[model samples]
Structure formats: C-alpha cells, structure tokens
Target chain A: MNFPELMGLAFVGLFLGLMLGSAFYYRNRPAPFVRQIPAFGRVRRAIGLAVEAGSRLHLSLGRGNLISTRSAVAFVGLSILDRIARSAAASDRPPVATSGESTLAILSQDTLHDASKFMGADYDPLRGQLTGLTPFSYAAGAASLIHDEATGASLLLGSFGSEVALITEAGDRTESLTLAGTDNLTGQAVLYATAQEPLIGEETYAGGAYMGAGGMHQASLIAQDIFRWVIILALLVGAVLKLVGVL
Target chain B: MKFPFSVAVAIGIGLITLAGYFLNIPVLQTLRMALIEWATTLAAVALLVGIANLFTIHWNKLTSGKVGGLYSAILIVSLVLTLGVVGWFGPTHTYSKWIFNNVQLPVEGSLLALLAVILVVAGVRLLRLRSSMLSIIFIITAMVILLATGPLFGISVPGLTELRSWIAQVPAMAGARGLLLGIGLGIVAAGLRVLIGSDRPYRG
Candidate 1:
C-alpha cells in the first residue's frame, strides 16, 4: 500500500479498536466520571435558571452543516443540544435551537422532539429555526433571535468563525449567561473575549461527556484522550529523532 | 431490530465513502462520486426546506402580531424580492451581482468591522470575567498583536515585528495544530460511534 493509504488504515484501525474497546468496557459497567468542565457547569446552571424562571434557553448551532467538513463539530453541537433539550424538557418553554445550516436545523428539531418525547413533554416545531445560511446573516439572525427571545442563557457551540462575536456580544448586552465554544481559531479567540465561559479547542467536543449524553459519549471522549497522548508521544519521539539526525 | 433503518443507511453510505477513499477501487470510486453528488442534491433540497421553514415561522409571527412581526415581514419581503430578482436575471447577471455586492457584501463587511470594537470590549471584560494570570497574558498578547498590525505614524518598534511573528508562528501555530489533531481524532471517534451503532444521530 501507498504511504498515505497505509497511514489512513493505521489511523482507522487504532480509532476503531479504541472506540469499540472503550464502548464495550463502559457498556456493562457504570459510566466513568468525566472531570468537571467549568464552562459546562455554567451551562447546567443556565438550564436550571431558565427552567426556574420559565425563560427560554437559546442554542446557536453555528454555521456548520451535516455534509460539510465541519460536520463533526456540528455533530458535537447536536449532542449538546440533545443533552440540553433533555434537561429543559420539563420547562414550560423548551430550549430554542437555531442553526446556520438547514440540515442541522432539521436535525435540531428532531433532537428536541425526541428529547421532549423522552421526557413526556410536547415539542414546539417553531423552536427549532434556521436563522440564516450565510455567515454574517447567520450571526445577525442569531443575535436578533437572542435579543427577541429574551433567553436566559445562550449556548454557542458548533463551527463558527469571527462572526460569532456578534452573537456573543448580543448575549452579553442582554445580560444572558453566554457559554461559547467553536472549532475555528478566530471564533475561539473572539469567544474567549466575549463569552462568560469559553471552551477552547477540543473542549467543544467534550460537551456530550460533560453534559451526560450517555456512557457511549463518555467512552468516546476517553478514547480521544488516549489517542491524544499517543499522538503527543509520537510527536515527541519524532522531534527527538530529528534532533539526533537519525534521518 | 432496535436499530433504525436510517442508521443502517448511514453506515452503508459511510462505509462506501470510506472505502472509496482508502481502497482505490474504480467501481467504488465511481459509486462514491455518485453518492457525493446525491448528497449535494440532498443538501440543496434541505436548504430549500430550511428556507420554507424560515418563511413559515416568520409568516406565523407576522400574522400573530408578535413583537418582531415587522422585522419578520421585512425579512420575508426581502427574501422574496431577492429570489425573484435572481430568478429573473440569473445569478451571473449584473443585477444579481449588484444586489449581492450592494446588499449582502456591505452587511457582511459591516458585521466584520464591528468585530474589532467587540474584540476590544471583550478584551476589557476578560479580566473582570476571569481574574487569572492567563487572562492577563491573553490581554497583553492581544494588545501586542493589535499594535503590531496598527499603523503607528511610520514608526517601527525594535523586536516588535519579530515578537509578533514568533508568537503567531510558534505558539499560535502550535496550538492551532494541536487543536486540529484533537478535532480530527474527535471526528473519527464520533464517526465510529455512528458506525458501531452506539450513537445514532439519524435515529433522532
């Protein structure tokens, strides 16, 4: 096999083996504890506050679509949405979900619907919205929704760019508790500046584990961590070898 | 039997796509390309559905005399007008380009420009939100980067340019690469969850 193909196969094998191994390990046993993510604590508090006050919680799914390269981030966002919807299902006003992509908006609706059903609550189709397709339009539309809906807390998660500042700023202006995370570097920087609690880098992918999506979600996170260490070790080894002029 | 048909379909398509990438088989490649085309078409249809959903929701708000009914009306009207114009003149036409340039680009640009002020405001609030050494360092780095990029009366600070380049190239690039690697692994894990039927987003 070619080098690239071999590398791809190795990655796939390692990922699948770790994932399946972890999943099986966690299936019968109790879910392993995930360390507290401070930002996620803020999200939980916001959900509780919204539930208590009868206020709406807003979730911006950002500008990621299912078919795009950002699909993984979008999926992570959806997983978080699922968790939030489950938590907020008992409230009179369920959480409002807005997405920049239509496919994600549709899936958000499904998530809410399923979560509400699981909690024995009615679902509101209007709550899941496609705010805008284009980047700036999406931000502007999401910002307007945050303002108009009078959300108690705005959770910004998914794939976003610098346009995320608009949404976070609006949340700040409205005095809503804003917890934000995105895969984009610029968006992360902007969110760090603007959001009350900002999650950096791969922390965005930790939402499912932090928010108690399921054991499977938590297991996947453990696998990711193990793989991360492996990658770091490999990098260090490569650097040392290069320093020694082994090549 | 508890597994949904949607999950099965997702796994099937995903495997085909993965095999096409790794296996280098001609038939699989052709099928993968066709599947990708189908996926694109599905996305376009979903976009239309999303637009329709937007219209319906806004229309309901307008009819219900909600607080933002006026804005909703404006949005719907603008959407209709823009779509009509594009349909009549075609997207390549000057009129379409003019509408995009005049309306869309300017609005987008204005939002981007607004980010600069927002960044400053956010930087100021960072200390208040999180009183930590890291927060202080973050603020200083941001200030340095801003100053480095800003026009400073034709004056050049010694070591400023080098510092900026080092920060961007070394630390920033390193963090970015790490994040990319983590994100890549996360994606693979999430996809594996789907493939293994442990997580069925499609079931939702």
Candidate 2:
C-alpha cells in the first residue's frame, strides 16, 4: 500500500478502535450527562402533544441512496424514527414516515413494524411511505401531506437540498412544529430560514444520541469529542508544517 | 450465541464490505462487488414495492372516497399509463422521451421556480418572525451573495466582488469544512454501532 492509503487505513482503524472501546466501556458504566439542546426538548414536547391530541407525528426522511455517502444521515433518521415510533406506538395516531428513496421507505416500514410489535400495537405498513423519487417531487408530496394530515410535529432529517423550503412552509401553514436538518449545505441554509428548530450540521447526526437511543449512542458522542480534538491538533500541526516547508 | 437471521446477514455483509474497501485482497474485492450488486438489485426491487405501496395508498383514497380522491385517481392514471408506455415501448423509445419532456420536465421546472420564491419568502418571514442575530446575519450574507452576483443596475461596487469571494472562500468554507468533519466522525460512530451489533435496527 502507498503512504497516503496506509495513513488512511490507520486513521480508520484508530477511529474504529476508539469508538468500539468507548462504547464498550460506557455501556457498563452510568450514562454520561448530555448537554441540553433545545431541539431535543422540542421533540420531547412534540411527542407528548401528538399522543395527547391524537395528531400524527411526521418524519421526513430525505432522498438519500442507502449505499452512498448520504446513507449515514438517513441511518440517523431511521434511529430517530425508531424512537418516535416506539413512543407513539400505542397512541391513536402513531407517528408516520415519508421517504424519497425506496430502500429507506422499506426500512422505515420495518422499523415501524418492529416498534409497534414490541409495543403490542398493530403495524400498518401504509404509515411508512415512499412519497416521491425526485427532489422537488418529494418536497411537493411531503409538503401536501404535512398540510393535509393534521401533522402536529414534523421532523425533517436526512439528506435534503434547498427544496426543503417547501416542506418547512407546509409545516408552518399547518402551524405545526417543524424541526429540520440535512447533510447538504443548501438544505441547512434553507432550514435555518424556515424550520422552527434547525438542526445544523452534526446535530442531525446527534439525533440518536440526544434522544437516548442507547449507551452506544451516548458513547459515540464521547468518541466524537476525542476525535474532534485530534483533528484540531492535526490541522494545527499541518499548518505549522506547511509554514516550515516540512509537510 | 446466535443472532436473528437478518441481523447475522446484515453484520456479515457489512463486515465483508468494510474489509473489501480497506484490504488489498482480490477475494475481498470480488466478494464486495458481488455483495454490492446484490444490494443494488434489492434496492431496485424495493423501488417497485415502493411504487406498489404508492398505488395502494391512492387506490385506497379513491375507493374510500376521501378528500382529493379525484387527484388521487389522476395520479394513479398517470402512473399506470406512464409505466405502460415506458415498459412497452422501452425506456429509450420516443414515446418515453416525449412523456418525460412534455410531462415531468414542465412539472419539475415549475416546482423549481416555486422553490426559489419559497426560499426568499422564508428568509423574509424569518426576519419578521425571529428577528434574532442569526436571522440578521443570514439576511446580510444572502444580500451579499445576491448583490455580488448580480450588481444592482449593472453597477459594480468597488471591492464588493472581492469581499464576496473572500466571505465564500474563507469563513464560509471553513464553517462548512468544520461541519463536514463533525459529520464524518458521526457517520463513523453510527456505522460502528451497527457493525458491532450494539444497535439492531433490523431486528424484528
């Protein structure tokens, strides 16, 4: 292997090791305190409101191909959806999911099914829908559903683009609580202008950890902190090395 | 200890894929390609299933006489007709191209135009609704981008172009890169969780 590729492999190996170690160590220990994030607070409130009002909670999983760069964000969306589904499983109107990708839609149904089964509620595959394939089409279909379905709260997470404005506007038209985030920069910018709670950047990925999915989720946060500092150090060193013509 | 069949399969394939990407083994490469092909095929079938679900939804709405049933019926008709044309005449045929050009393109283009308006409206509403420091900054940045890109009355303000380029290439790029780094780390952590079976999302 070449030097750069070797370095890449080493970095990935270290990352994997750190993550696995931290997750294991933290799993047996008391859960660490997670800092308060207002978005997560709003999500908790939305869950309660949905259950009490019998209004549907909606999750808009963006159009991300499953085996691609965007899949991680979509997976995070699934984690959030899993928690939401479990919470709303016994309610009169359980949470619903909409996706632009077929694979995500199928997985969403499976997640909902698992949640409902564990909660002793009947699973309705119809709740997890593949709304549209294209960006604008997905936004249109999801937006109309937001307006028509009596959605109490809408969580827009995954990979989206500037077309997210349509979904956010629809949520606003219904006076629903809309928390949105995406891996795309344009989507984040639009969401900042539109969503009630805009999850910027890594916040979307932090959904599972903040929602208390498990110890592993929390542990991932710990690993992330360490890795972040390491990156900062590397950046500084690299800058110094470049200045000295040593890099 | 035994895992559920689906979970085992998921973990096995995941490991193979990860190994294939990192390791320099011919066998691993072949295995990875095969695994990815299988996954793609599954995804394609899932698309068809998704379409069936979509049809089922609209069909139910039409049958039950729900609100906007007519729209549902129209959607169903368009979907079926388009599928028939594409399947019968082949995707590369003139009819398929005609349908895409005449139908889907206009609709998508209209939506794109609508999105532009919606973004601007949202930005305006944000200023009115929130009126916070962030919103103010957002508007200012947006103004800079717009003004720099399209000079007002074709008048180029001195240094405005350079200032916009600096804002874009420096501060904006830095912030974006930082976010990307965090996102990358988050992806790794999430993937690890799945690989280790710490989270069994596929579990029934």
Candidate 3:
C-alpha cells in the first residue's frame, strides 16, 4: 500500500480498536459518567418545565437526507430525539419532532414509537411531523409549530445550513429554552449568535453520550477523545521530523 | 451475544462498502454502488410516506378544531393543488416551472433574505443573552467583516480590505479547519459505533 493508504488503514484500525475495546468494557461493567454538557442540563430543565406547564418539547431535525453524506449527522440527531422522546413520553403532552427530510421524519417517528413503547406510553405518529420538504418551508413550519404548540423547549439538532438561524430565532422569540447544534459551520456560527447554549463543532455528535443514550454511546465519545489526541501527537511528530531534516 | 441478525447484516454491508473504498475489487465496488442506489430509492419512497403523514397530521388537526386549523387547511389545500397541477402537466412543464420560479423560489428567497435581518438581531441580542468574551469577539468579528465588505456612505477605511482578508485567511480558516477535523473524527466514531452494534439507533 502507498504511504497515505497505510496511514489511513492504521488510523482506521486504531479508531475501531479503541471504540470496540471501550464498548466491550462499558457493556460488561457500568457506563462511565460523561462530562457535563451545559446544554444538556438546559434541555433536561426544559423538559421538566414543559411537563410541569403541560406544554410540548420540540425537536427540529434539519434538512439531512438519509441516503447522503449528511446521514451520519442525521443519525446523531435521531439519537438525541430518542433520548428526548423517552424523557417526554410520560408527560401530559408528548414531545413533538419535526424534520425537513422524509426519511428522517419516518425515523423520528420510529424513535418516538420505540421510546414510548419502552416507557409504556401510547405512541402517536402524528407527534413526529414532517413539517416541510424544502428548507425555508420547513423552517417556517417548525417555527409555527413552536409558536402554536406552546413548546416550552426547542432543541435544534441535525445537518442544518444557514436556515438554522430561522428556527433558533423563532425559539428565542417564543421564549422557549433553545439548545442548538449542527455539523454545518454556517449553522454553528448562526447558533452562536441565536442560541443561548449552542453545541459547537464535534459537541453536536456527543448528544447521545450527553443524553445518556447508552454505554456504547459513552464509549464512542471516549474513543473519539483518544483518537483526537493521537492525531495531535502525530501532527506534532511530523512537524518536528520535517524541521530536523534528517533526510 | 447481543448482536442480532440485523446487526450482522449492517456490519456485513458496512464492511463491504468500506472495502470498496480502499480495495481494488470490482465486485465489492459494484455491490457498494448497488446498495447506495437501493438506499436512494428507499429514501424516495420514504418521501412519499412522509407526504402522506403530513397530510394525515394536518387533516386531523383541521377536523379536531385545533387552534391553527386554518393554517393546516391552507397547507392541505396548497399541497393538493400543487400535486394536482404537477400530475396533470408533469413536473417539467411550463406551468410547473412557472409555479416553482414565481411562487416557491420567491418565498424561499424572501426567507433567506429575512435571515440577514434575523442575524443582525441575533448579533445584537448576543450580548444580552450571554455576556461572554467569546460573544463579544464574535460580534466584533462579524461587524468588522460587514463593514470591510461595504463602503459606508462612500467612505472606505484604509487597510480594512487587507485586515479582512487576513482575518478570513488566518484565524477564521484555522477555526473552520479545526471544526472540520473534529466533525470528521466524530463521524468516524459514530459510524464505528453503529457498524459494531454498539449503538443501534436503527433498532430503536
């Protein structure tokens, strides 16, 4: 194999090994406590307040299609939706999930169904709504839902673009506790301005761990941290080697 | 073993797709491509299912006398009208293209244009919401870029262009690259979790 391909294989091996090892360890034992994500605490509080107020919690899964590169981020959003749905299943008003893409909307409904089943609550597929197929329409429909449904908290997560600001701003206007995150840089920047507590960069991917999805999710976060350090070390070593000019 | 038949299928297909990327095997590559095509077709079918779900939700809201039932009615009517027109004239017909260009595009453009004003409002509220050093820096950087890109009342600041380029090229680029690297690593970690049956979101 070429040097680049060899490096890629080595990195893949390292990541898989770390993830599998951590997953196995955590599954056998107890899951470790994930570092506190401030936004998660806010989300928890919002759920509590929504339950008390007999209002709804809204989740916006952005315009990420299931068959595209954005599918990974959409899955991350779905994991968070599962977490939220479980927490909100028993409330007087179940949480509502809105997605721009059709596949994600179906998955969100499935997630809600599973969460409700696990919690012994009746599942209503209507709670998982496909607000709109297009970006602007989706944002408008979601914003309207947040306003009309009396949503106490809006968690904006998924593979959003600049249109994310519309949904986040709507949440802010409605006085809902909004925690926003997306893999899109422009969306992140907009969330920084709009969202009170925004998950930046890779933090969006840690939703499953932060929300206590399972031991596997936590283990994946730990593995990611290890891989990050390895990459940093490799970069430093490469820089030093280049500086020394041993060749 | 907690791994079920579904997990095994997922892992099997995932490995084949991964191999297609790195290995010079024509069969694996073809299989990967075929699987992707299947997924795309499934996604299209899912879109139809979603449209049906949307209709049911709105129809229920309208019938049950929900607060925003009128809006739901409007949505249902609009959707039906658009679908009827498309069905009658086909998607690429002049009427359909006209509706897309004249109605849909304009509304979408308006929303995107509204984003600029919303951004400024958000920027103004940033300090009120969270008076952090980072927020302050973010506001200042945004203002600098906005001002440098436009000549305010026909007055241009000296060196502003160079300053803007430097900021965009250096600090902004570095931050973006860092975010990209983090996202790439996170995607890999998440994918491995799913492939290994460690996190079965699909099962959920």
Candidate 4:
C-alpha cells in the first residue's frame, strides 16, 4: 500500500479498536439498552405514524460548547439526523434539527440537506434555524417550538448538563415521543432524565446504528466492545501481579 | 432573512474552522484571532448577563425570604467581593493568587475529591448493576484507565509509561479522529440543512 493508504488502514484499525473497547464497556450494562430499545421502537413507530399524520420530527444537538467532548458526542446525534432525514424524505414530512453552538448550527443544517439530497429528496436548508446560544434560552426556545402539535417525535442527544431536565421535561409535557442521552453527571438533571430511561455514558455512542446509519457503525461498536475487554484483562493481570509482588 | 443570515455566518465560520485544522493559513489565522477577540468581548457581555440573572433570581428570593435566600445573599456578597478584588488588581496579583490558591483551589479540589470518592463507592456497589459482557468490559476498561491515570500506579515501573503512551496515542487518538470525521460530516450537514431551511432552530 502507498503511504497514505497505510496510514488510512492504521487509523481505521485504531478506530475499530476504540469502538470495540467502548462497546464492551457498554455491554456491561444492559438495563439502559433494554430501556432504550423500547423507546427507540416507539420513536420509530411514531415517525412512521407521523408521516401519515403530516407531523414533523424534532432533533436537538444540545447546548454543548464546541471545545467539549459533548460536542463530539453531538456527531452521533447528527448521524441519527442522517437516518431521520432519510426516513422523513421517504415519507411526506421532514425532521427539524436544532443546535446551540454556531458550529453545530451549521452542521445540523448541512446534515439535513445532504441526507435529503443523498436520498434523492428535495430539502431546503433555510428551514433549519439557529437557536439561542445560552443553554436556558436555547431550551426555552426549543421548548416553545416543540410544544406545537405538529412536532410528533423528539430526540435529545449530545452533551448537556442540568439543562437536560428542562428540555426533556418540555418534551414530556408536550407528550412528544422522546429519546434522550447525555453523559453529564449533574444530579437533578440525571435523575430527571434517567426517570425517563435516557441513554447514559457510552451508550450515547450507539446513536448512529440506532438511527439505521449502517452495519459499519455496528461493526465499530462491536470492535469497541472487544477492546474494552482487552483493557479489562490487562487491568486484572496488572492488579494480580501487583498483589503477588511479581513486578 | 434570519435563516439566510445565520447560514451565511455559519458557512463563513465553518470554512474558517476547517482552515484552523491546518497549522498555517494567514487569513484563517487572522480570522481566528479576530474571532477570539470578538468572543472575549461576548464573554464579557455574557458575564454581565449572568450577574444580572443571579441578582434577579436572588433579589426576588431575598424579598420573598425563600428557603435559599440566605445562600443567595452569601453568593452575591462573595461574588461582589471577588470581582471587586480582581478588578482592582489583576488576577495574577499576589492577593488574587493567594485567594485562588488558598480558598478557591481547596474548595474545588475538595469537591473533586468528594466526587472521586463517590465514583469509587458507586463503582464498587454498582459493579453488578449490569451483568452483560459489554458492561463487564466497560467497567474493567474504566478501572484500568482510572488506575493507570492515577499517581498510585507508580510511573517508575518499566513499560508502564510505554503502555500508557501507546493506549493514548494509538487507540484514543484513532477513536478521537474517527469521531472527528463523523462530527465534521454532521457539522457540514447541519450547516447545509440550515442554509436550505429544512430544520428551523431559531424560531421561538
């Protein structure tokens, strides 16, 4: 292979390794997945039903700053958008995406456009709006729009702190089908979300596959699982060796 | 007009952000510097807004003599004093550093230490919370990362540094890159979506 090809292969290998590791870590806790499955199923059903009902789906990228790891998690949410947009395209409706950061605002817009284009559907990017930058302001804004009866389904994914509760509560109040995820450990926020069975920690990584992106994502997730076990074994060995004074 | 304005701003910023990926670009570098300057100004405004919000919330609470009124009063006092001192003398001044080192650092450190304790306790008790193979892997990897990252592991051990370096450089970096690519794609898509008017986040 050429140098670039070699580097590409190496990078792919590393990505797969990390994904396997994460997947393994996630498999340890099945309760969240078990809880998320039915919710996603409901969302899928809602989306299908909404297409017939002429309702739009809502997706939020959260209020995470660009420098944060949560912003990185927002990519997973975008992957979901890719799927949601495609599904919406096949149907009569389109999904609405909202983001807190300027960067994410642009991304949400692009994702919607491209997903539609790739699916051979017509989509106008001007429809996507840039919400407020402040967490509370963004939440309140999103809450107001989503309260509209036309919004049939809601997905809250990405980096969020205590604001998760406010947004999720809004969705709940509207009785919109919602699937939420965040890695933030703020107590009340987490309690509010978990009560609704939101995906936690690494499970947020599964956003792509859950949205039907492709098998490669699932493959990456599986790879993450395997690497996670490898790390565990290494840790156990290291601990045992330390105990025995073999080092 | 609103969506178009936001989309135009987004496309301009996105290009600059992408250009920032490369270490060298005079225009991009200038733009970044300008952006930072603007951001610093905006941040100052945000700080003012936050203070206003705090006072509004607290003053109402104090007038109503709510349960958290005293806490708000204490907060206002502390915030005013700290801001006063820092504004009078720069943050790097001896008195400022003293306050930071003695008061702020300790409080923050104690809070972090408390979190560490809670995490460890929760980790132990919740070890069996999820018995799935994936959960085992996650817990195990987390423990390894935690131990390896801690000073208790003793960096003097042979191969320890190498292993840590390898894990960070190879696996972590790779995963981070893939994630970055995925994020880049999503960002591009979102921007286009906004430009085309498919998703409306600006409407309240």
Q: Highest lDDT, which number?
A: 2
**Tens-place lDDT digits, model 4, residues A1-247:** 3576565445444654554454456555542232245656777888788788888888888766654445656766777877888788876668888765656666677788877777888886633444445565456546655764347888877666554455555665676776777545452234222224356445566566566665445545455445445655876799799999996
**Per-residue lDDT over B91-190 for candidate 4, one digit per residue giving the tens place of the 0 to 100 score:** 9898888878887667656645544554454444334543567446545655666667778744555665577777778875665554444443333333
| Tens-digit per-residue lDDT, A119-220, candidate 2 | 999998999998888898788889978877879999998899988888999999999999988988888888999899999867787888888787678777
Question: What interface RMSD does candidate 2 have?
Answer: 1.4
Ranking by lDDT: 2, 1, 3, 4
Tens digit of per-residue lDDT, candidate 3, span B85-158: 99999999999998899989999999989999999998988998788999999999998999999768988798
Candidate 3 fnat reads: 0.76
Model 4 stretches astray by more than 4 angstroms = A1-13, A16-36, A90-92, A120-122, A187-195, A245-247, B1-204
How would you class the docking of model 2?
medium
Between prediction 1 and prediction 3, the one with superior DockQ is 1
What class would a CAPRI assessor give candidate 4's docking?
Answer: incorrect
For all candidates in order, the CA lDDT equals 0.85, 0.87, 0.85, 0.60
True contacts kept of each: 0.70, 0.68, 0.76, 0.00
